[model samples]
Target: MRFKLQTDYALRALVYMAAKQGENCTTDEIAGYFQISAAHLGRVIRRLQNHGYVKAIRGRRGGVRLDRDPESVNLGEVVEVLEEGAQPLDPPTGEPGNGVDDALRLKAVLRRAHGLFVNYLNKVTLAELVAEGLPEPQPAQQPSEESAPAEPQPTVAAEPEVASSPEKTPEPVGAPSAAPGYGRPGSPTYGGY
Candidate 1:
């Protein structure tokens, strides 16, 4: 099934933003990038901004940024928002005889098909879709002591590499845990990772 042109442009913008880093995107930039009309794209940007997907900054060099993480933005929800009143078939409205029952059955089949389509789309996140083309390469992260052990310790019975069983090394102490209510509500870091 085909989406409206507006939805297509919005998806393109979303994917482009997902592939970018740091700098916000300008409507002119998006228009230039896609070779679409700036005015038409302006409307699309406004619609996306209204839906909490993009946020516009006001200034001379101002531009829009992806407000929510790509993974959190569901494709089905995006389609739903963009295609609110544009269903493929009219729903089953109760009416007697004359192939109306057939219409109802077709509508039911369409609904099931749509359900399956949306479920499949929901399973595939935007992050997964854009992973192959992330704008910049991120630095490799160092594994933390809290997350994993420093090194593998060979057992005494399986003496393959080591001559003797070495003494266990102590794990480095981690930062102190936040005290009760220390990082609770009213903190700047609240709701942050």
Candidate 2:
């Protein structure tokens, strides 16, 4: 359920690039802005480049840019490209006849749920996330003295206690006084003492 730091960095770098639009941004610039290591950023950029998410240029004015429009890129696709062997859950492993078969069935169900989640993500693009503009919160309205009073809260019902069987009763502490052979016929204390 957790993403690696590299994936997180890659997403941040992509967002920065998307924000810049047509401008070319250098790894050093991104590292400086995010306070990350330049060497780490360089590696992240290379991975993005290999995944066709970014295009790198070489020269004095050269840097990295998004290969495609932000609207055309899905967040899930970006995650897949940036993450290696990244999955929502681990695959099940076990022998056929063992109880592992049941575990594998449960894993399959979980995998299906994960697939649905990924499908939802695939439907949303980065542009959608960026398109949401910030709005100011509205102030709360004051209640008038003439307004009706709120209704009282309802009381919760108590649960009934269940009685236990005689066999389940616990013995009294320090109440027993019996020797190993006290009840035996041949013992020193045969019946009563």
Candidate 3:
């Protein structure tokens, strides 16, 4: 269920462009804003351009501008395109029919959950993401780990709470893993993740 950082960068870049309207956003600009790599963001920008989300301008004023309206771009569709790098699930294997039925059931559940996720995203547009304006405070030019001077550590806070939407209800917790002779420390057949 994890998404790569490239997806995060792509969405951020799009939001920046969507907010800018006519301004062309450069990879360097986005990279500096998000404290990410410009080269990596450039590759993401290329993929986005190929998918018709943006058009890249070359030369002195080289940058990317939104090709389609923000409202016209569905988040789900964009996520599908960006998730091309996700590894496909390997088919059920080993132990002839030992867990084929269970595996198939699990696969079906995974597929259904994934479909619901994407379908939910489909209802939202890029416009909604930028409606509240860009996030702040604008980050300073980030110093590299080695060159940056160390500062006093701040007290860590508890995990932030998230507001749940009325449109969705939480699923019940599932049973714990039933791997035989596993989970317990120093178990004979324990396999660490």
Candidate 4:
């Protein structure tokens, strides 16, 4: 039902690389573009390199590059590999067969659900994800002389708009304390970054 942080980071980094069309990029570049921590992304990049999904180049003009073609990299395969050992249902704590039939059945169901999720992702590739297009990088803002030091003016605050339906409502900044299936920040369940 939920992916680990590594999985999310890997997918995001891959998509960014795929969009670049084989151009090499630094971990900090990708992290900055996504507004994520470069340190965390660096670890993810190392994992990706170890898996042969990417290669690292050392030198002033070097950076990480996708080793495989975007079309050949399956999203499902990436997720399944990165999410290995992440179980929705933890193993029974007590002795086996100690009123655990229901738990066993639930584990089987969860496995099947996870399989379905991967199956859906298998139909998509990194190339397809990049084909959707990414947002353009924002340029740094510079103050202009015309906008310099204006006199303060009193203004009335406008009321916030209320949506008629929950679906129409905008999500609050920083999300909720814990997302539906995600854990709270800094917790083990917290999706990495």
Q: By summed lDDT, which 10 consecutive residues of candidate 3 come out lowest?
A: 184-193
Model 3 TM-score (2 dp): 0.66
Query: Residue 93 in candidate 1 has what lDDT?
Result: 63
Worst 10 residues of 4 by lDDT: 137-146
The 0-to-1 C-alpha lDDT of every candidate, in the order given, reads 0.66, 0.65, 0.70, 0.72
Estimated TM-score per prediction? 0.63, 0.60, 0.66, 0.66
Candidate ranking (lDDT, best to worst)? 4, 3, 1, 2
Q: Give one digit per residue, the lDDT tens place, for model 2 in 32-129.
A: 77666778779988988988889998899999988878899886787666565466556656778687788777878877886776677588665654
Please list all clashing residue pairs in model 2, or write none if there are none.
none
Across 12-116, the per-residue lDDT of candidate 4 in tens digits comes to: 788788888878899999988876678888998999998899988889989998999999999888887788756678875666688687788888899888778
RMSD of 1: 15.6
Once superposed on the true structure, which residue ranges of model 2 sit more than 4 Å away at CA? 88-91, 95-98, 133-193
Off by over 4 Å in 4: 93-99, 135-193
Clashes of each: 0, 0, 0, 0
Indicate the residue-level lDDT of 141 in model 3.
32
Error of 2 at 152 (Å): 33
Better of 1 and 2 by TM-score: 1
Count of clashing pairs, candidate 4: 0
Residue pairs with backbone atoms closer than 3 Å in model 1 (clashes): none
